[model samples]
Target chain A: MNIFVFVKRVPDTESKIRIDHKANKIIKDGLNFVLSPYDEYAVEEALRLREAHGGKVTVFSVGADEVNIILKKCLAMGADEAVLLKDDTPETYDGLRTAKIIAKVLKDKFMDYDLLLFGRLSIGADNGQVQTMVAQLLDLPQINVVTKLEIEGNQGTAYREIEGASEKVAFSLPAVLSAQKGLNEPRYETLKGIMMAKRKEIPVLPLEDLGMSAEELAPLMEVVNLESPPPRKAGTVFEGEAEAAAKKLAQFLHEEAKVI
Target chain B: MVLVFIEVREGKVKKSSLEALSEGKRRADDLGAELHAVLIGHELDELAPECFSFGATKVHVLESTLLSQYSPSGFSRALKELVEELKPMVIFFAASSMGKDLAPRLAAWLNVGLATDCTETGIKDGRLTVVRPIFAGNVFATMVFKASPQIATLRPNVFPLVDPVDAKGEAAKKNVEITEDQVKDAVQEIMREEGSELDVTEAEILISGGRGLKGPENFNLLRELASILPRSAVGASRSAVDSGWIDHQNQVGQTGKTVSPNLYMAFGISGAIQHVAGMSSSKVIVAVNKDPDAPILKLADFGVVGDLFKVIPPLKEELKKIFAD
Candidate 1:
């Protein structure tokens, strides 16, 4: 049960995002970056799978040196090894190119694995395409937004949450799966694990090592512009008795909003 | 020509796919091209009329016994073959669960650029440009595809479904051959919810509850409120869903589902930034909470400062009367 989990560092969901209008990107200065919430679930699922099957879990991420923060965190969460594919391009919003790089590495270097995992989507780009693209590039079976999973031998069954139902899917081993919420409650890093992770050195693979250049992995789309959504106007607040306010709200919805 | 992928579940075309067709119609009109819709499944020719009514000039049915149930490899390969033969100018998909999973694989197969969850798609300078919400609705990014046959997914409920017209269109049938060896993943069964519940992304009105609702049992109040409103679905904040008060499918937040309903009613919700990013695009918002300074109050078009439990009963009663009239 060799499990590989793909992770990304994204702005904390709680952080206030400021745009750099001049560059058509978000201003990252002073913003807190954390492991994407969905990726945390993926890492935890990898750890659990390793614990159950008695094998190793390795975490992989593609970014600049700053991505080490998230890789270290995953190591502290009980992953056996961590690797970083260096891409110094300040902001790479192309999920397809990223997927291509990861798939190439998996094909050329680490071809033997029981499972490959990813978050449903990266929070910053919110494209949610990389996992499926990687699966296609590698010609492997894949499932996304998985909530429940069971494995035995080389056969795996995953439950994907659809609109109003859960689709049960069965696939062979060496498949790709993306973790959705409610998969499991991720374990907090123990003090001893944290101490060990602080000293462990993670191997970094430069893009050159993979025989790929930035130009070859150029994005498929260009960001023309970015703007903040218009702020909602302040509305009248009804502070009277509960019954009266409720009635007033109904009246407002019927008359002013005209939604009813 | 523009190509739109229509998703069918239980032999019925999904409303979100219709929304995608509506969007494709607009793009076709803008580009002065024909709108072509494809349904890749068995016994789907019956659903072609809905596509024509929504402005499809032609409907293509690609069916195979192996393609009856969605196999990521099978469906994507079928669509890839169709795209190769027809060579449409653009491809559109609704950002539904199936679409989200299938579109990227097709894009990779075709080696084309794709924009996901787009709210605005149009022809600018004779090329496809799309605007999609990124960072959970905090930022909107305008993008231009750099390759031929631009591919994109439109967010549901954000795009309006055009009025159905009594127009006729041609239908083409093609039998796809998919070997069992190609379908590496297979769907075993589907466990549906007890009732036919609307997905939050497709609901016109969303009645959402939060931690202030107290517990899971209290969500019945929200269910009752939703019952009073037509085309309404019950939603929950991430906190409520994380607290195990509701299913994650009903969650509306950055980490959950992003919704742009006509009206969003947030009750007992504190409106964390992540939660706000999901529903801020809604046309109108109404918040009911005891704390006057809750962040959701500021973002809502109507705010009621009172105990939700005390307010909900009267609110439901008042809405019932209003609808009764």
Candidate 2:
């Protein structure tokens, strides 16, 4: 069995995103990028599956050269290899196109592989749409936000958290699975693992080399504006006894805000 | 034109689809394009009337036994076939578990672009600009797809559901066939979870506890309140869940379930952005924390500054009185 996990290098979540005061775009300087935490789960799940099934796990990413740092983290966590789809990102791009480039590059390989996986959603883009789109492109069966998994022979059972309930789904080999956080406690890079990761492979597959055309999949949307949410006013305060506070709060909702 | 995937589970429509339809209607109107809906199910004609009420002019239904249970290949094939034929301007899917599985596969097959979990969307100059939180809701990213059909998945509960003034409409019958090969890999069994004492995601009202309740026994007040409110459920912070005071299923935060209920009551909880991201969309948010500086109070519509041990029981009693009367 083999597992391929997709990863993305995204801006750290806490960076104060600044819309260039004049350029009408986001300023990319001074920003730190990391392996999307959700994808971390994907990598961990793959490692866990490989541990049980006896196979190699390959991790892949789509972004600039810096993305290798994030990919290396996967290797450090015990993945067998890493592939960086190196392309200088434009000021803006779509997840769907990202999925296409990934699918085009990995489809043939995936056909040979037993399983393909990704994080439930990326923390950077926060649009969990890419992995699913890739699964669609590959025309493979996919299970999303799988909470748990078990292997019996060639078949695997995926447990997904559905609305108000949990569902167990079984799929044969060669399926796509998107993992949510807490699926497993992603192991940290131990001293031994870090030393061994240096010997692992990190290959750069150019988008053009992969034979995917950005122009073939024409984009449908463009960003006219970029800005952070308006800062909220500091909240008001109230001090009093419990019963009186409750009465006042109720009065406020009913008479003032009318939200109750 | 916009193509919205209408999710039909167990014969009826899920609440998230209504939000998708509403979002689709707005996007279609903005783009000056037709708003079409695709419903794939085992047998879903009974849901046609409901789909139209959400502003779908045309309903494409693919009836098949394979769809009775979810199969990714079948869903992707059905959607890929539709996308090829309809050539929608933008595609909308709710970022529920099912949509998460369906959207990417279709986008991949079509060789298009997609934005997932878009918190906000607007069309300007024939382009769809989407905004979403990044870095675990630590920052916001405004982005655009440089791909066709502008496929994007909207997070459920993030977008407000619209009640169209004249919502009544008729759906034209759509005859589409779904083959067994299309829906490969079946969900053989569903290890159904036991009935939840509090699942805030689907609840109309949520009572979430934080670390301030002091002890697990203190949750009695919150539980007592939930029993009387038929639509209410209880939730807790990650701290509470990890503390063994509550189940992880009841956790509501960045790492937990996001909810937008009619009412959200926070007891002994400080609002973290991760915490706020999950439930800030609620119609009304009330917090009862001892500290005035609690983050939860910043966004709350109503605030009660007091001790939870004393505040919760009387508040529950008052709620009982108001509702029982």
Candidate 3:
């Protein structure tokens, strides 16, 4: 029951996001990067599966050198191994292109895996396409936004949330599942685990080594511009009796807001 | 022609799909392209008239028993066959849970690019360009496809649904071949919450609570207010969800659902950047909190510096009176 979890490093959700209009990229100065919150659930699930099934949990991430930090964090949280599929290209945040590279790597190597895991979406680009694309490329069964998962023998059952209901899906081994919130509470790294993780070196595989040309790996989607949403102006604040404030707010909504 | 994929649940078309079809109609008119709709399932031709009223000039029904329930492989394969045959210029899908799951698989099958959760779409230089919120609505990225049959998923409730008008249209039924082997994943059951309340993403107005709600039992107050308003739903902040005070489906924030409703009323919520990222696109925002300096007060169109427990009763009464008029 070998498990493969794909992880990503993204700017902390609390951090202020600023765009570099000249470069058409995000400004990286003085921003604290952390493992994507959703991916934490994936890594935790993988570790638990490995513990119960008596196998290894290997984590994969495709990004530049900065991504290694997240890979190391996964190792600190009890992952057996970490691999970085390095991408130094100027084109950033293409889900299809990234999926192609990963699919190629998985096809060429690591053919004996029984499970593939991914965070539902990365916080930065928020595409939520790569895992499904990878699953399609590899021709594997997939279930996204899974909340509860159970594995027995060579089969797996997962419960995924929809708008007003939850679907119970069953699939065979070698399937892909994307983690959503409430999957599980991820554990923090222990002192011993951190010390052991610091001594491990993650192997890096460049995109060029995957035998795909720049044109083949090129992004099919173009980013025209990146900018902040229009600023929202702060309107009047009523400070006084609760009843008066409530009445005034209702008046504003009726005449000015008119939402009701 | 532009193709819009329609999703049906329990024989009824989803509201988000209608919204996507309406948007597709607008884009199709702008580009002078025919608007067509596709539904992949059994016994769906009966729903074609609804699609026509919304703006689809033609509805393509890909009927297959294997596709009666949604399997990522089965539905994507069926849609893939249709796309290859029609070769439409573009494809549109509502960014619902089904759309989020199926569109990418189809895009991958065609080896084409897809933009997800787009807020705006139009023809630019004779190709489709879209605007999508990235970094959780903190920033907007304008995107364009580099290949033919450009695909995108429009965010639910963000796009306006047009009034249905009678239009001359036809439904073309095709029998798609999908074998049992192709659908390795099976849906055993669908567990719906009692009464099937509206999802927050599709709600017109939201009554959201935060830590100030105190406990899980306090959520009933928000639910009471939501019930009083038409097309309203309850939402929760990250703190409230993290504390096990509510379900994740009701959570609205960066890690939760991004919602753009007509009116958003936040109670006892001190806006964090992540939470604000989800609701900033809301049309009108009002906040009630005892803390005058809560960040939500700054972003809200109207702020009340008072106790929410005290304010909500009067607020509900005032709203009831206004609606009575």
**Number of the candidate with higher lDDT, 1 or 2:** 1
Judging by DockQ, tell me the better candidate of 2 and 3: 3
Tens digits of per-residue lDDT for model 3, A148-208? 9999999999999898789999999899999999899999999998898899999999877
What is the per-candidate TM-score for chain B? Answer: 0.98, 0.88, 0.98
What lDDT tens digits, residue by residue, belong to model 1 across residues B73-152?
88999999999999998999999999999999999888778899999988988899999999999999999988878999
After superposition of all CA atoms, the RMSD between model 3 and the true structure is 1.1
Candidate 1 lDDT tens digits, A1-260: 89999999999988889999998889999899999999999999999888888999999999999999999999999999999999887765667888898998998888889999999988979999999999999989999999999999999999998887889999998899999998999999999889989999999998878987666588888999999987788888889898899989999999999999
Q: What tens-digit string does per-residue lDDT give for candidate 3 at B159-272?
A: 888999987698999999878989977677889977548888989999999999899998888888887899999999999999999889899999999999999999999999
Model 1: number of backbone collisions? 0
lDDT of 3 at B82: 89
Candidate closer to the true structure by DockQ (higher is better), 1 or 2: 1
Give the docking tier of candidate 2: acceptable
- Model 3 stretches astray by more than 4 angstroms: none
Cα shift from native, residue B232, model 1 (Å): 1.5
Worst 10 residues of 1 chain A by lDDT: A87-96
Give the TM-score of chain A, superposed on the true chain A, for all candidates in the order listed: 0.97, 0.91, 0.97
Question: A189, model 2: CA deviation in Å?
Answer: 2.5
User: Relative to the true structure, how large is the alpha-carbon lDDT of every model?
Assistant: 0.91, 0.74, 0.91
